[model samples]
Target: MDTQQNTALTRALAEVPGPLPTSGVIHITLPHTDRFTVVGNHLAQHPDLSCTAVGLAVRIQSLPQGAKVGIKALAARCKEGEKRIAAALRELEAHGYLRRVRDRLPSGRIITRTVFCNRPAALLHPRRPAEAPPQPAKPEPAPAPAPVPMQRPAPAPVCHPTAAPPAPEVPVAPVAPPALSAPLFVPRVPPPTAPKAPRRPLPQPGELTPELDRAATTFLSDLHRHAPQFTLSEDDVRRLVPGVAAWLERAVRPDSIRRTLTDDPPQPLKHPAKLLAHRLTELLPPVPPGVDALAALDRPRPRFTVTPFQTCEDCDRAFRSPTPGHCRDCRETRAAYAQAAA
Candidate 1:
């Protein structure tokens, strides 16, 4: 039953009459006067969304017919951190897009089911008076007087400008008084009969190094300058920084920019556009407790088996797939008509 529904959804999406814009919130037309929007703003805000959420939706929509995906299969496809994957599942469930059933194992770990196409009618076809035709956006009327005006003139000057001065001619004699023996120095008087408050233990000597202090300042300043769109919490800072909270207290510090460049560099990028982007490598801070160690973005690594591959169904030509599906060459030749129609 579930597979049949998935196949229907895939067909509906594949045969959609209009071109689907990928850049913004996607409002997709569904069967039975239903529509759904993949809110782009939400995705942008939560960049940490696991690939699982998106991949699951895509896979379900691509099913040929009568096929149901298990939880483990969905997780394997997502390739995201555990926390993010869980978050994505919860989000889908709360939005009525999924119905999760727990399948507990004897070992105490449980798997969750992913049910698509279970959205209630209330969400899919919400009725709200046709949105009142947007009211044609009437121009605003002139504003009434504000309770407090912005500017007012000062009152007239209180003092008169033309004043007269009087002159005196009489002179007086001066007298000096004699000083006695010098008085003894007085000590500071203590407060009398007051309850003494407990003094706090002197703050344990701050642990700071000169280099760390400078790096921290530079790190924060650069964040404000470059990535002004995003906000980071103290935990974020601690996580980003290698360990400079103590070093800032010391007077001596190294060149912050140099230290960061050496310690945490941006990943090596192949695309020209990505290379030209504002490098996050320079802004990394010392690693704080519980924070993952900072690593350069460009560090090379062996390609994992999870990397996708493709084989042409017609020509039998094999190709390394960057995305999903068969080799592009084979798809072009065999599915050309469908591709053009799509």
Candidate 2:
């Protein structure tokens, strides 16, 4: 009875026409009504984009506005490094899927504004005159139309099957179609730089003093505590030692350096080493002036006049003098009195 039931079930299964019909990737797609992103086929199935670039583009498209999509931010979120992410971004740019514009804020800060395009070719490519509408098919000539005896003046030599080509089965007519995560990474020729002046080489943190090295290393290693995103590797810490040492050389307090570096950092701090390097490069304070210069700046200025008003001792007259004394007239009067009495 079990065998009979198994046979019956197999028959039933074969008779039923259901979804399991192919040996390939199957889609169990559901209609997406809400919170769905529309991706263009050009980007989704671009023949030129690498797998990484395609995936990254999709991720970027699906991201909400104001989300941190910076190279560092994405690197932190995804299983990719800055270099890979950057290259992917470059691919996107080259294909017109991304644009990065440099905008100057009212505060004069230059910021990269990234724009993402679902269909970049539309904007980047010149408007192609609307493709001519396809027309109905017309019958083509037979590959080997033997000459009719009545029409032919003479019998022509027959061509080989290989020599005669068939008409195209169908005319192929395939129609073809940034908010910014970072500053333009477009490779640009660097402007001619002025000849750099020769000066004493800067002291490396390691070469300067063991104490400085120790201080820098300790600060970098412990940076993750204050800012979790700054969790750095041994190499990163080593790379950043020079920046911290620069702060030290300028006599900026270690605490001050930590505070400045850590203060209100961009959310999703992607690359701590790079962030530290930028701060070190751009925000460095001018070398703290020498003691003599500081003294000059700090010297006290008198609030009172150079010569103060003084009251005469004998005449009770006011006089301008450094020390308490009589005015000119009062002094003469006193001297006259003394001489007359003598």
Q: Which candidate achieves the best TM-score against the true structure? A: 2
The candidate maximizing lDDT is: 2
| Runs off by more than 4 Å, candidate 2 | 1-21, 125-342
Q: Give per-residue CA lDDT, model 1, range 265-322, as digits (tens).
A: 3444233222212223323334343323335445567786765666666666777776
Per-model lDDT: 0.50, 0.78
TM-score per model over all chains: 0.21, 0.32
What's the lDDT of the predicted structure labeled candidate 1?
A: 0.50
The residue-by-residue lDDT of candidate 2 on 1-342, one tens digit each, is 999999977776566556566686544455898998888787778877999999999999999987888899999988989999999988888776787889999999999989887775455345546789899999997799777666647778887666566677987887655132333333232335857656433234335588888888898898888878778998888877887887887788878988888787787787777777777776777777788998998999769658889998877878789888778998788899999999
Lowest summed lDDT window (length 10), candidate 2: 178-187
The clash count of every prediction, one per candidate, is 23, 8
After the best TM-score superposition of candidate 1, give how far the Cα of residue 278 lies from its true spot, in angstroms. 13
